[model samples]
Target: MPHSLLWSLVLAVHIISIALWIGGIFYAVAILRPSLGLLDATQRTSIMLQTMSRFFKGLTHAIPTALISGWLLILHEGGFANAPWTVNAMQAFGIIMAGLFARLYFGPFQKVRRAIRPQASAFDSIRTQMLIIMALGFLAILSACLSHPFV
Candidate 1:
């Protein structure tokens, strides 16, 4: 829509970054977490902690790329007022999602990782939070799709 090579590249990068971050969450929720039931508590905790550590590492890059590129795209279209409601919704959801992730990383995530024998309650909370993030991610995707005039 911006009709520029830069815009297209930025858009691609933004989409890819978000896909990696949220897609990882989905995998953890749907595939990884579910399959871990057979393992003992220690094994599950160790595996999940390791998985989350790497995932969060990737998020450190993805979040910034997605946010910055999104802002650039917004500015390209003549700033906030000129951008569609869907874009605004996406931005709001993205920011909230990032904030939520940070909170969990520093709070429950850290708590469980440092525990000698982490409680099941901690992982349950994290799972709930992940579900919320996943739902928000879906909402953002829906907002983006609805941006299409034909939609």
Candidate 2:
């Protein structure tokens, strides 16, 4: 395949994966959480757990896709040695975001998943982690936009 075509495809995947992961978090935190409060405690917990299960499952795939595609995009531009400062910064931020997500998944998320009834505290922890990840994601996006050769 032509390099340009390959780069375009990879970039598209990277963007889509990012949108899915970040957009899901935004929807859950900004919309679903508040709306869910209308339900009774038991119903709320059940629904929230089910919703989060699906979201996290999707994230497990999306995060890796974003990371790998971003890495490939970076290589296509040039390896780390030759990449611009913005690319390097974006990569560092991406790594931090991924690490934060991993921690959230294994820590608070695991607790939430294992509970006979998901606890409010567990959800709170997940929310906190999500906020951090979202911030990092935004910063990474900014870095990408500023560093992009065509920008």
Candidate 3:
């Protein structure tokens, strides 16, 4: 109803979406991957598949929400031409991160799902892509911070 409240809600949605997507990736790479290494190949692939499947499904929803909320924030601040450089950079980074995630999901992840015994490379590929995405996410956050004037 109120202008400030609407902006706050949109910002909250954007932040939560980013956290869900990037934080999940961080968990998978930093936590789950290592935990899987302790298991045998069969167990590793099985658990990795199950975990990734759920993560990907959740991200399927998060990604769009993040994008849309980001756009809303941009519009609230003013359209792209009127927005600051940092906002534009964040938009670029967000799009790139989304693209990378889509590639990982459709490419190596598909092979992993179909293989009877997926190789370590498949998992490594996924991790590498996720790391890249996470880094981009950090950059986006940094850009958002930069847009704020420092006291």
Candidate 4:
């Protein structure tokens, strides 16, 4: 493929990934999280775990694509040291978001997965963690949107 095509593909993947990340967070926060409060622990926990697993899978695939495309954009535009403050800030924010994502994946997510396989009582804990991660993800996306790195 031509370089432009490759870059276009990367941009498409990045945009889609951001949408998935942001949309998943929005759904979880605005819908699933609230609805979960009404369900019994067993049902709520099980559902939450399942939903989270699916979201995480998408996130796992998306993050790398977003990072690579974002990095390429940065390099093609200008190296980090030469980029404008807004561009530099966007990259910095992305790194922070990535770190938070990693923590969510390796930390609370793993704990929830391990704690609540068969137990319904563990649903509360799962719900709590999910909300925390969802909020953080939402904030990160908001930051990226407001930053407007593409401009």
Which is better, 1 or 3, measured by TM-score?
3
Among these predictions, the greatest lDDT belongs to 3
- Residue-level lDDT of model 3, residues 35-136, one tens digit each, is 888888889889999999999999999999999999998888878789889999999999999999889999989889999889888888888989999999
Extract clashing residue pairs from model 1.
Answer: none
TM-score of each: 0.93, 0.93, 0.96, 0.76
**Candidate 2 on 1-151: residue-level lDDT in tens?**
9978888999999999999988888898889999998999898888888898899889899999999998898777778689888888888988898898889888888888898887788888888889888888889889989986782
Superposed model 2: Cα runs more than 4 Å off:
149-151
How well is each residue in 1-151 modelled by candidate 1, as lDDT tens digits?
A: 5568778898899999889978989999999999999999889988988998898888889988989998998998799899988999999999999999899888999898898888988899999998999899999889988886882
Computed on alpha carbons, the lDDT of every model, listed in order, comes to 0.90, 0.87, 0.92, 0.71
Model 2 is weakest, by summed lDDT over 10 consecutive residues, at: 72-81
Candidates 3 and 4 compared: the better one by lDDT is 3
> For each candidate, C-alpha RMSD in Å?
2.2, 1.4, 1.0, 3.4
